[model samples]
Target: MIGVDTNVLVRYLAQDDEAQSPVASKIIDGFTPDAPGFISQVALVETVWVLTRSYKMTRDAVADTIETLLRARELVVEGAESGYLALASYRATKADFSDALIAHGGRLAGCRETVTFDKGAASAAGMRLLGAD
Candidate 1:
């Protein structure tokens, strides 16, 4: 499998770069299940950040993008189970995708609880409050 960078993925999905989009598409779309492209967790997070912060994609759209990536047979996502759990949490709650991913990753790692100072994460992502009374 070949590793995919965040920029390549963003270029492919966004299709906004006139000079790079076609090339990104050609490489990404050419992948097959037997020779899948691999997306790392860092790249995935960066892609989400760019989609939301830069592209201003709506929550539903971001979710759809992530779901599409997860379901793609020509791609291998790192920590896929955690990604799925995070997606479920993101869809069902007010938690950010990164927070939900952190919580789910902790759970998968056998953490009794993930402690956090962010109330949104604590309440929405099932993380334990670090200093709540």
Candidate 2:
């Protein structure tokens, strides 16, 4: 299986990048049923972060992107269901409550553990630091 990174996904989603979108589309299309493409949990997280922060996608747009990603035939990840639920919950909460809702959704989706760089999120149930640092 071929592994895709956040940049690839961003290029696929953000067609505004004239130089990269076509290439991204070609790469995505090349992955037929015989040859599947995969993406890691870290890639998914980074994709969302980039879409929201750099591309200025709204919460709804992010959710839509994630839903499209989940529907793809070849994508792979560890906690896809949990991540989807977390995104949904993130959309519903007030700014201050978003992390709490994400944590709750993570638990509800049967996540054995969640990893985040945010200290507050790390303290939430079922969450752990992405690294010891």
Per-candidate TM-scores read: 0.96, 0.68
How many steric clashes between backbone atoms does each model show?
A: 0, 0
Tens digits of lDDT, candidate 1, 3-113 = 999999999999999999999999999999999999998888888899999999988899999999999999999999999999999889989999999999999999999
* Winner by lDDT: 1
Cα lDDT of model 2 by residue, 28-116, tens digit:
87886578788776777788789888989887887788777766776665466656666665566432123544575567667776577
Window of ten residues with lowest summed lDDT in model 1 = 124-133
Candidate 2 lDDT for residue 17: 80
| lDDT of model 2, residue 99 | 59
Error of 2 at 121 (Å): 3.9
Candidate 1 error regions (>4 Å): none
Q: Predict model 2's lDDT versus the native.
A: 0.70
